[model samples]
Target: MTEIVIETRSGTLAGIGEAGLTRFLGIPYASAARFEAPGPVAAWQGTRAADRFGRQCPQQFGGKVRRDVLESETYGEDCLYLNVFRPEGGSVGPKPVMVWIHGGAFLAGGANAYDASRLAREGDIIVVTINYRIGVLGFVNFADALGLPAIPSNIGLRDQIAALEWVRDTIADFGGDPGKVTICGQSAGSMSVSLLMLSPRARGLFHGAVMQSGAVSLIHDRERSIRDARRYAEALKLDQSRLQRLKTMDIADLMRAQAIVGKQLKNAIPAAPWYDGDVLPASFDEAVATPTAPVPLLAGATRDEVRLFDLMPGDILPTKWDDLKGLLRDQFGPEQTARILATYPRSRKGRIALGSDLTFVMPTRHFAERHARGNPTWFYRFDYAHPLVGAAHGLDLTMFWPFSGLKMALVRGGPDKGRRAELGQRMRSHVAHFVRHGDPGDIWPRYEAESRKVRIYDLADSFAANPEAERYAAWAGRDVEPGRGK
Candidate 1:
């Protein structure tokens, strides 16, 4: 085993060099007090071991503990850290960099959940995975509700920006090109990517972006944020006027309160990034209409994005015709609901199809159409499905990181390891090409409103022109309220 030591802006990190890649894990980018904005890490006196993973930001992983929770035994408030993976030998020229943000409904995941060694080795690019605060401590806008006008909003996003800033300033020492950075994520992390695109603070941090199964529609407004925070405070049995007590409360007490409020809200994860008028603009539609940064984008969704919700222990999915109609009425009103119902059948499969299109497919297509007008963009649909789960919400992650072993068993299925590996290589190749070059090569054509061409990834990958045009037309110009769809 070879040990490598490199100097960063914060300190000297000792990492491992093997398999033609150098990995430095758990390096702090910033530090912060609870609910406060993050600040740069002070320089350390001596070399710090980056061999073991750092503590994950405090979170509750539903009933079952996730891999991230098991990997890192420690969890606490001071959890702003990032990991770096680059080619082993220093290249003559700087390689492209890919920074990944994880997804856990803005509640549960961390940087340790991902292993980017395959991407770094195969793509010959530097990969960085980061941890940011989540849940009430990270989001929960308290500026106006608590009368504490000085409290910072969107501390999670601030942490992400600080990590990006660290990458821009020090990535060169690890053989990465800071100017050629690509930020990508899935689910809530994907929402963060879109929000970052609209954020002035994250303006020049990355050159390109990739979003999977999420868009700007998930962001909450100030009014909703205040309501959620007040609800959380009430769940804790704390006086709303005495908000200072929350800052010093036990972390376990806060998490229990969060769980209670989350149950009351009928949401598994209650808190998320919100439009603060500073980091994010007032209107997502308006922001997308007139984009500030015309960066290259690779955006797409799985064919049955919402089917994964069926596996959860709840009545979340619509099982019957009446349930489906009720949901449509709530989302699109009676007039549009009648039209949507007429377009599809009244069965379980029909409901799943409608819910999938309404929540994930349509939003992604709309964003791709608007973004492609001024930027180099590519759109795709993942059609590979498991026998039981189908092409669900997180199936794309298995393909993006194929060598994840048993972590991907739920999606990959049995006796088809070879086929899964082939598909994964194909998808990763396209991503690697897009990261190094601005476009996704000549095989996949650029998406335009006139053509509406989309790459379909399945057993046999092919290009199609608006395959679901009729279904998409049903949702034309219709805007669902934020947080209602998910």
Candidate 2:
């Protein structure tokens, strides 16, 4: 391996050359204190070695040890880093850029978990993976709860905007076209991308967006945000008199408080992005009706998103019928809830369908419908089933890049492995095309209001016009308040 140096506005970075790509890891995009907006990174004197992954943002282990959690034990509060991957001698000038944001339910995820080398080389595009603050440090609205006007409401989203600003300012040096940047993410990250489309501050940073299994559905309203902050402060034993102690407290103590608050609110993420009028729209209705940034969009959800929740402990989603009913009723009320419930059968399948549609499917399709009204939008459904869990919540993730052996086996354990690999390639090709030309090629038709065509990704791919129209009809007029019930 050899070193490749690139000069940026901040300083010089030395990346390592791998098999067929050059990788620059652990590049700091911005820096921030506990609850403040991100600030510019301080310039360095000499060339900085960026050969290794950076520390993940400090987060709580949510009752279960998963793959990303085990990958690294070292984490810190100052964890605003990103990574870049570019193909070796692929194109003459700048290539289309794809920026990836990972999803951990707005709580626990990092940038180092993903390796974008293969995606970059095969697609002939530059891929950037980023990290931002999560959990209490990022999402909680301490600004209002503690009368601390200096703290920001959406620090996590601010980190994302800062990272995008860094990309816009510095990507050209890394053979990336900042003008053709496409933002892609899954779950909470996907929600961030969708929310960014509505954020005035994030307007020209991206030209395209791809959301997988998420949209702006799980965000907290202002009351919920402030209530959560109070709960967090109470868990930390910090009243207004002791508010100053929060910044100096150990990160472990904060994590423990986060975990405690998470357990208290069963079947829900304790902290999430709130509708702050500054960074985000002031109200849920305004956010929903706000015209999104004029960018081509490719968004979709898997067939059985809720099934994966059953296998995990401490379910973030409502897996039981009563819990799902309460949540929908909490937002949609009795009559609308009854209309939605009448569409499905009363069984395990019905529970999965109800929860999946309520949590992921309907919200994603709703966003696509709104986006398609003014901009180019392509919608899809991932139908490739896992041997054990069917087409689960994160099944689309495995198709995009190579994962660990255990994850691959658990998701792709059944027959037709070769065909599944081929399907993954097709999906990536569509994404690469979208990143280049702002469309996912001609084969996948645009989602229109009349037909509502959707591309279905399965062992044998096909197209459908308005699949599950009945369920969509049920959720048509309902503008349910997001993050109402646990």
Candidate 3:
């Protein structure tokens, strides 16, 4: 391994070259206070060491995060770092770039969790993974509830946008093409990509996108957002007059308050992006009706998206039939809710299907369908069932990076380990192609409303025309009205 230095708009960074890749880790892209929007990083006087990862955003210890990531990462308030991986001795010309946003249901993840080495080396592209504020510090909106005008809504999204801006102004120095950047994510990260497509501030920052296992169904509506904020304030024993004290409180104190609110909501996400009209559309209905950024999109979900959550504690998703029914009733009319519920049986399999479709699958399909109307679009479903969980959520992440033995076993186990590895390679190839050419190659056909073409990834990759048509029909016109999970 040897040390290499590259100059950027901020300063010179000393990265390392190791095993056929050049790694620049923990490069700060932006800075911000507790609730303010992200701002530019200060210019450094000398070459800053980019050999190790920066501290992650302050968050809770466990809950939905990978065990390895939870053990390895450290957290702090000033965590606005990004990592860049470039293939060693690749084309001298500028290469396509992919910016990855890690997902933890908008609360528990950091950029260090994902290593983009294989993606950069095999795809011959520069891959950038970013860290954004999560949990109460970044996501919980306090602008309106506490009468704090300076506190911005969706600071996490703002951090992501800042990272992209840094990439646009500085990536070319690392042999990356600014115009060919593709933003990609999984779960909450995927939802972030969807919202960014609809965000006016994110226009022109990315040329394409790939969403895995999530969309806009999980955002908080205005009423729910303010309600949750008030709950947090009460948990912290703060009011509008004491709101400014939030900046000076201990991180542990804030986390304890967040936990209090989480238990109160019982299964609903305590912190998530809300449609504040500044960073997002005015309301959930307006967001659905608004046209997204006219960029090529590739998005999909797993066959059994909710199964993983079923094994875990808490109803982070509506895994029970009754829970799913109540959420549907909250969103749709009595007649429409009954009609949708009648489509599924009362058995275990039926409940799993209902939870998966309503929470992740259908929302992904909705985004893809809307995007296909004008811009280029490709949709897919991961059908390679896990031995125990049957292709659960976060399974796609294993297909992209080289995970630890325990992590890989979650999705790549059973008697077909070799076959699953091959499947991962194919999926990565398609994603790289999409990032490069604004399409996932010619083999995977573009998604159109008339055809609804979808690529199914399994032991043997195949194409299907609108898989699960009945379920799609049942959810045809219904939309998730983000609110308090009553």
Candidate 4:
């Protein structure tokens, strides 16, 4: 095996080179105590082996679907590490960098799950995937609610910022152009990209962004976040006054308490980024209305973003037309519900479409629309779905990283295997183009208010003017219901 050594700000790292690509895995960007902001990693004299993936942040597998993807990996608290993949050959100048953040509803997933060698080779760019704290340890708001100044809020986001800071300071040694860095993510990670776009701490860290199947609507209000923290504390049998006990609690106990609280709240853990007013603005609307960084963005969602959740065993699915209408009324209220129902047909497929739009598609469009007002933006809709599942959530991941053995079956199960591979390559090429240049090539038009065009990705990829325009119009200027946006 070919091995190479590179010097970074923290220390000297030894990595392996293969297939015209070099990989540095599990390099620490920063170190931090539990529930504290990340601090710089101290320089070490000896070269550290970055051959294996770092331990994933402590997490639990929630269901079969999650188990299928996350259960095989080991996890731990000291998970603030990132992996770097770059072309082996030297270039005249540094290449563009793409930092990826994984998605698992802010509860599960880590950097190890993704292999960036293909993206690095194909795009001829540097790829960095990060591992950050998730669930209670990362997102629970305890500083203000419990009156504990020691407990830092939004530590997960802080970890991401620390990783970006590392890239800004050290990527040049690895042949990456930090000045042209692009931050990309899916689901919760996409939400993170949007939040970082507005975060003062994340300013100048990245020049562009790509958000897939997520948007700015996932953030919770401080009140809601504090309440969830209280519930978590109660599950741990600790009062607000005894919050210090959490610092010394066993990792197993902490995870068990998190699971208990998650179950009690019907899996609605309040463990998400919140509007701290300092780190994040009050609302997504406000943040996008006046962006702190007006960087070009590529954002969109799949045709069935919520079908993945619905496929799980739950009584949440509507049985009939009346049940669907009632569900809509309960979520959007009577007046807006009437408008939505009028715009959408009353059938199982139609209900699923509505759910997809409310949860992922519409929020993405809203953020894209507001962001387009100032900066260049491109939007897309992933329409290809495997025969087994129809355009489900996270299905687009198969297109981005098709070589992954874990995802190959999911992408190749449908008819025409060769055709699917070709499509996946096309999608990756588009992403590579976006990372190299701000635009997504000439075929995809920049989103504008006058022409709400979107690139549709299917067997026959094409551009369309305002796909599902009328349905989106129904929810315009209306307050999107809570829980529906997730």
Question: How would you encode candidate 1's per-residue C-alpha lDDT over 1-486 as one tens digit per residue?
Answer: 688998877788899888798899888988888778899788998999989778889886454333343234677787999999887654469999889999878887888878888888877789999999998788877675666766788889989999999989999888789999999889888888888888989999999998888887666766778788777767777554666777877777677766666766542256777777888886554655647467999999998887887676543233345655665688778888887777777666777777677667777778777788789889999999889878988888877774445645755664336777778878777877788887777489988888889999987789999778877777774645445423
Candidate numbers sorted by lDDT from highest down: 2, 3, 4, 1
After superposition, the stretches of candidate 1 with alpha carbons farther than 4 Å from their true spots are 63-72, 89-91, 288-292, 314-331, 403-407, 482-486
**lDDT tens digits, residue span 1-486, model 4:** 788988877789999988789999988889988888999988998999989998788775442223322224556677889999988664558999999999988878888889999888888889999999998789888786677877877889999999999999999989899899999999999989988988998999999999998776656777778777777777777766776588767766666666665665542444788877777886555665656477889999999876787775432223245654665677568988888778877766887787777667887788888888889999999998878768888888876774445446755455335777778778778887888988878578998888989999987898989888888788873434343323
Candidate 2 residue lDDT tens string, 106-125: 88888887888878888889
Model 3 whole-model lDDT (C-alpha atoms):
0.85
lDDT of 4 at 464: 87
- In model 4, pairs of residues that clash are none
Candidate 3 residue lDDT tens string, 1-486: 999899988899999999889999999999888888899888999899999999888777334333233223566887999999999776678999999999998878788878889888888889999999998888887878788877888899999999999999999989899999999999999999999999999999999999998888788887888889889988898877776689888777788787778877755888989888988998878888989999999999998899988987766667777778887887786887887878888898888888898888888899889888898899999988877788889877777677766645645564225877788788888889888888889578889989888999888988999788877887875666435424
TM-score for every candidate vs. truth?
0.93, 0.95, 0.95, 0.92
Tell how far residue 179 is off in model 3, in angstroms. 0.7
lDDT of each: 0.78, 0.86, 0.85, 0.79
Q: What is the alpha-carbon RMSD of candidate 1 to the true structure?
A: 2.7
